[model samples]
Target: MATVKTVTTADAAAKLDELLWVVLWQPLGLPRDIRHTLSLEGEEFELLAQENGQVVGGLVAVWTGGTEIELRHLAVASHAQGHGIGRSLVTEFYRIAKTKNCERIHTIARNTSGEFFRMLGFQTAPGQAPEHPIFREHGISFELMERFVEQGTPADCSTAARSRGG
Candidate 1:
């Protein structure tokens, strides 16, 4: 099983940036600095999934509106997909949100990834997603998705609240 850990130091953040570029951006022909350009303007943090100390997946999220968090990016290496690494990262994200007293989590999910977010309990939020010509040209789209954070104790970090298969 992969272990999910927070990205605290510059090196960890750099690793996550690289992972995001390779898994989520590079294939789309996005610029190398795309991550920096799209980074949220508020309080943000990153989480990484590691197997045998190698990063294989990562997520970037930011606190929004004082009571909400927005998942800005999520990516698992092509070679590591379908192995629950993404799930583990999301589960840990839920735990951190609960500890921070966030009431909900939101994400602008790509059309290709909407089903994955749905499987993790995110519902299509009632709003129009921002338009991006590059994505549209690539046959990709976006949607606003959100999920309420269930009330839980600060110490609760288990997957019970957001595990697959209910």
Candidate 2:
């Protein structure tokens, strides 16, 4: 059985360099410039999947203020891709977001991962313009997908109560 755990920023600061290269940089063919600049120093959340004491997948995301979060990186070791590790990681993240009262979550997904995001209920943001500046600056031809969280809040019937009291 695979177990998922949060990767602390302190541990990520040291381990991300190796994991990113093996799981994303080489496999995804990310540019060296981008890989070199990736840092977990200021990340707000991260998670990793472990089996037999070896990490099989991980993700990093940022709290982009005001009830919004953006996923920065999500990678599963090539050997572990089809075994539901990615799905579990995302599910855990969604649960965390709900607890934090996040209203929405989004990610810039590459073509390969777009379907996976869609499968998890994310939809392409409806707009002709890029929703984020980084998309334009990087010249990355990717889709911006988002999902709104439905938070249950107590219903207020203040006006009716006041009228009845009067």
lDDT of 2 by residue, 84-158 (tens): 888878877777887888888888787678877776767788655244345444544578888776566322122
Deviation in Å, model 1, residue 104 alpha carbon: 0.9
Candidate 2 Cα errors over 4 Å, as ranges: 28-43, 127-140, 152-166
Residue 24 C-alpha lDDT in model 2: 59
Off by over 4 Å in 1: 153-166
Assess each prediction's global lDDT (C-alpha) against the native: 0.85, 0.70
